[model samples]
Target: MTATTHTRHDPAAATLLRFATAGSVDDGKSTLVGRLLHDSKSVLVDQLEAVEAASRRRGQDVPDLALLTDGLRAEREQGITIDVAYRYFATPRRRFILADTPGHVQYTRNMVTGASTADLTVVLVDARNGVVEQTRRHAAVSALLRVPRLVLAVNKMDLVGYDEAVFAAVADEFTGYARRLGTADVVAIPLSALEGDNVVAPSAHTDWYSGPTLMEHLEGVEVAAGSPDAPARFPVQYVIRPQSGAHRDYRGYAGRLASGVLRPGDTVTVLPSGQRATVAGIDVLGTPASAARATQSVTVRLAEDVDVSRGDLIAAGAAPRLTRDVTATVCHLHERPLRTGDKVLLKHTTRTVRAVVREITYRTDVDTLERRDAAGALDVNDLGRVVLRTAEPLALDDYADNRRTGAFLLIDPADGTTRSAGLVGETSAWGAP
Candidate 1:
């Protein structure tokens, strides 16, 4: 029933676990996060005192632990979280970066932005409200974003009398739903965030629950270490050419490899131009590397001086497809509707080009997971499928196969505000396209 103590860590040897919290409003997500931090001794004394003073000002007997995460003034005033709140904490096992996302339906876009890069997502389920619509909605989003691991924290167990049957029923129902949503794994835990039971330590009240505590599960779950699932895709972010640096004449392509591995001797093809050349050398973060793995920022020198620029993609092999027409699923974030014939800017990996909405197929209802016929336009926060035609050819991969290469953003051409988050290729019934 005691919290685990952190051991001395060599910074280089520590593994970082980036996770996000999601659930319906009033599900105690922020409270659970606060409990995780407080029980783990991650919160400083000053921070805890500030929360205590704030709770006293509001005439509360217990400190509002949610105040630790709901840092915005408007959030404290309205008692609702609006934006994504990121917190960092470290344990002996791993370093954690937790993203506490808003639970309101209107702020679903914020959850998407948070969960996009998460290694794992912790979904809080109120023990009283077992598997509500919003719970299902958040689960669907996790599946759509392809988050590797999921933890179903059935919070507020004390309120439910710490009943094993209640926890079992909720976990069972969600397990079935999550499997259908295409989530690979789900770890269920029963806990009370307010009382700090089963969060950082084991809960004696729920002895029937033999599973690992919330902290135990989070620290133990396996996450892919930037492993490549598809072919190599190095989108050119900057073309480096020093006029008089090292005897001059150094043309290196600078970009982060989105997927797959790149070696010094590998043959790469510049997309849209179809120019082929061998990689002469690679510099990974200023260190000369024989090869570079996915997600590494590196500069590559090609054997032949091919005409490549910021908008071009240097891909390995013939796996990546180059096309002007893109069939993708979009989660519309803007209040202004996205209709066919709307001129927009499509931003894929480092490239942004003018594009037109070719067609609106249908919109997937997030709550019910239904593909309703699109009324030729997508409203705010509507998940829809559409086709887009860009002014230039782009090298794209199926999002289901590759998250980095298959993802894109749709921006308003007039004001340059982001309009939607797009995923290339068809999505499942859960709006994962």
Candidate 2:
């Protein structure tokens, strides 16, 4: 199969991917990340020395790789990661941005915030413990968020003597449960995160395993390429008119492409107003591209003036669905529960509007996947179906269709803080009585 070529700001680098890690306490999530970075030669000598020094202070022979990820003083004292720590590293093959997140029950909200923009998720599992509740919780969140790819890293093989049976058992249990959560792909790898085994370099100790190493799998995974002819959806961010002498007629509509490919001479429409125009050109960081794809930032120039503004979607071919009614499944994060009849702000893509909680469907029991009718509303860490009536129409898609356009965040109108995360789906059958 021929690999799809992605456009990069610098022709030298291929593309950048963002991923997040989740697991239970002592499951070796941080150690796995630290080892991946260290074995990839992404760490500097000074950083390595600091980790070693910290290890010695904790009375350890080998340096604790987890310390490299848990950088905050409070996190170090608690021996856990509290906030999301983003790390950047690049190999000759690809560049990566990793979001290292916390594992405890109280910090589930933080995990959601970190994994919101992730294209893939790495769910670490302790080989000794097999499939635990924490593993299930992380998998549930990954499914709820609709992450495209999933990698199950079964850490601590050394303690289990690199036993193939142990690896298979953990892999089977985790994969079985993950399948129920709607995971698309699950690749299992047995490794000792602390020993640099099968992280960056292939592990000779695991001749029984025949899969690609963690780093190799990541580098070779086929991410979705840009769509060239799909419906164009550009939520206008801000209008840019340089007003400089060199470019006085430069009326640039600034925003990231939500879907489809756009090029010059294409006929386009502005949503909510039904105005139509032709594309004159595209600008990327002051340069023009023959075409641009979804997720790329660009300024689109229209051949004629139409009433365009921020929050309006500029589309090509067909327009996205616009309505004030939204039925979605949401995971409540804040301490306060989201009850029926409460008014909140639903932020979908770049559009924000008032949304009333029309109904509370069934609250899903995480462990059993059973619908519970007893709960009046969803509390923290609870998943439930919700019916919301927005004050205005939103150009939105189904969560299963386009994650970028289908997903949304509920903000507290009183305090301006995010309260819940939602995915478009049928809420009628799932709602509570």
The reply for model 2, stretches above 4 Å from the true place, is 1-12, 73-82, 241-246, 426-433
Q: Over the stretch 168-235, how does candidate 1's per-residue lDDT look in tens digits?
A: 89988888888888885788889999998889889899988667888877776666766654578899
What does the lDDT read for residue 355 in candidate 1? Answer: 99
Error of 1 at 249 (Å): 3.2
Write the residue-wise lDDT of candidate 2 on 1-433 in tens digits: 1112222233255677788999998898878888988888998999999999999999999988777776642563664323677889998877888887788876776677777778888999888898888788787777777677788899999999999999888887877777666664788888888888888887888999877778887777766644566677788998886597979878989999988888999998887787889999999999998987898999999989888888888888766677788888887888889999899999987878899998987777665667787256888877788889998888777877666777888999999978899988652221223
Error of 2 at 391 (Å): 1.5
lDDT of each: 0.85, 0.80
User: Candidates' TM-scores?
Assistant: 0.92, 0.90
Q: Point out the worst 10-residue segment of candidate 1 by lDDT.
A: 1-10
After aligning candidate 2 to the native by TM-score, how far in Å is the CA of 184 from where it should be? 4.0
Question: How many clashing residue pairs, candidate 1?
Answer: 0
